[model samples]
Target: MSRAQPPIAVLVALSAVGPLALNMFVPSMPGLAATFAADYGTVQLTLSLYLIGLAVSQLAYGPLSDRFGRRPLMLAGIGLFLVGTLIALLAQSIGMLIVGRLVQAIGGCAGLVLSRAAVRDLFDRERSASVIATITMVMVVAPMVAPLIGGYLDQWFGWRANFWLVGAFAVVVLGFAVPLLHETNHYRQPLPGLSGMIGSYAILLRSPVYRAHIALIGFASGAFFAFLGAAPFVVIDLMGHPPSDYGRWFALGAAGYMAGNFASSRLAVRVGLCRLIQAGMGFMAAGAALMLTLALAGQMTLLALFGPMAMIAIGNGLVLPSGNAGALSVDRRRAGAASGLSGFMQMGLGAGISTLAGHLVVDSALPLAAIMAVSVAISLLAFHALRRANRQARELAARTRPALPKAA
Candidate 1:
């Protein structure tokens, strides 16, 4: 690892590309459907498939970056992002647009995976968690701000305007990244090939603590992705609200998430990861419960839809930084692989939930609310499992330790 750590701002910009591309174009989904004369399900593939691409590509990126170092892979990924964004901007058909999104996801995920690995390289567990928490706090701004820009761009210019802006943003981030980001991976382990990668992942999966952390990360994120998939359709198409209105309302959820991350950044080291995680999950569960109750009770206004989501966002913000730190800490030697696998689980579940929610939330937001509730429930169970596993390991260690000789 280079003694020089990259500035937090650079890391944020690098990481923000993925979320920016993901959220900025979301407000244009309805327009995309109208332009291509496709059904909503088909149009929704752009988001779901992009998520799947992020999931699958991270598997390779983590291991490859671990072996090759971070800077080069990150640059390559950003280059791919630029190319994909260009293709998307110029696409003539929905199929082409989906293809472009997949490419963008594959390339963009390089930054996401490497940035976390870089942090692990630079800091110990608690400190890394703190840093990641701070990074996420700032990074949340991208998704929160992106929708507003996306909505206005779509409304004022067209669907293509959003992609144009994304491309330009990527170019600027790329310019800064090339100069500032250096080799942060100081320890490079030998991964002979594909089998080595699989073996690394297997070792991580065998650990109950690691598995629990991944579960928490995956399902917690699933709640939000489900919302992203369904909310645009619910607000814009069904509720007959404009895209700008959807963007404005969506800011509430983003702000809540930012607040939660701010709390995590301050409290993670002091309060401990597990407590923070539990508290965050409590927020998530409550949010989902309230949302489902509202939907079942026939409260389908904008506040009813977005307000509970704000609560869920706060929970996610609290859980994610700690979850990532806990998982990466499991085997610091395999931090890259751990990061990759965790991201895979997170995005894979998200892709599935986003697609499912898009299909089910056609008539009402009840299905979306129900999905969030189930996801939050799973997250709570995962945190419980993590606590149990940690307790068992401690008990086993105590039993295994040799008895000390009595003092004379």
Candidate 2:
């Protein structure tokens, strides 16, 4: 209702900002190194430290949002982001640039965490999943376009221009979002003492349902990350394709992600979360299965690599949205906390998977294929376990129902 923007558009923009912040400057890395006369290892801290800051700040924002409302805290985060971007734009040394990036990450994460929490706040689980999928679909476009944009910006204006652009974007989004963002946390949980906060997290950690859902997301997406890590090697070395050809194939794989998101947005409301998850896992399993088959059979072709991965990408698109929404729904008062923790697991596990995939590719494409397949298989098992747990809990509740109606 605010004159700035609608809720959905705002969510889309908020979600998009995190990815843009994370990747938009990647193409500028070489230019950055040359500008500061630093080695690649030193310059890489700009990314690694940013990730560390991102992971840490997301954890803090969740519980803080529970105490405060989403709007003020998110606004504060934007303020921090803008301040950091300004610092980066003016940075005269590599250390200063790295510091700026770290601060930027601390604030940039607010959008990724809060937007998911806000979705749960505003909608039911299934609907939340559908909307989140839509937001995620839109957000993917940013990463796809970001590098190209960064490439041009670096060519035309140098690396500093990228930071300037990010700062401008922050200002624009802040102006647009201020009036539209409602405080969606209807139930203000009392500021927890340390012990109480620990107890809350303890309960969530103890939940088999929560753990299972988290694991499903962790490994399901892990397969995709594995593929991403291995793809360049497979395309350039194993399959004898050029880097540009890999880029084209990567775009096709990304299209598969878009396709899956489109399917989830259309079908999640109609078929429900469990069935949709099942279908997604099926796609993943089939894709992964084909990858292994090709590798084992010594085909080792580019089609074998990219074709099936596109399918896996599609599956992750479906699972990530639904799984994330469902995880947050299990703990309503702690949606912010839940979203943050789940995100941490997904990111942490994804990093691990990508690293392992890199190591596993030393010998042949077979190891990459094997690791990806195994990761998806693990996710399928976790999902089925969670589904079984849900059924058992429902049956137990039914059995415990009182017979007072007979007396009446």
User: For residues 1-408, could you state the per-residue lDDT of candidate 2 as single tens digits?
Assistant: 522324877777766676687666755654455689986556656765675676677767887888887777788888898888988888999999989998898888888888889888888988999989898888777765665566567767788887888788888989888988777876777766667666777778887788888999989988876765556556655666544455556656677888888888888899998888998999899999998999899877767788998899889888888899888988887998888778777766765776577556765789888999889999999999889877886888799998566654
Q: Highest lDDT, which number?
A: 1
Worst 10 residues of 2 by lDDT: 1-10
The TM-score of candidate 1 is 0.98
As a whole number from 0 to 100, the lDDT of residue 314 in candidate 2 is 88
Residue clash pairs of candidate 2: none
lDDT of candidates 1 onward, in order: 0.92, 0.78
Q: In model 2, how large is the Cα lDDT of residue 300?
A: 74
Residue 7 lDDT in candidate 2: 82
Q: How many residue pairs clash in each candidate?
A: 1, 0
User: Predicted candidate 1: what Cα RMSD to the true structure?
Assistant: 1.2
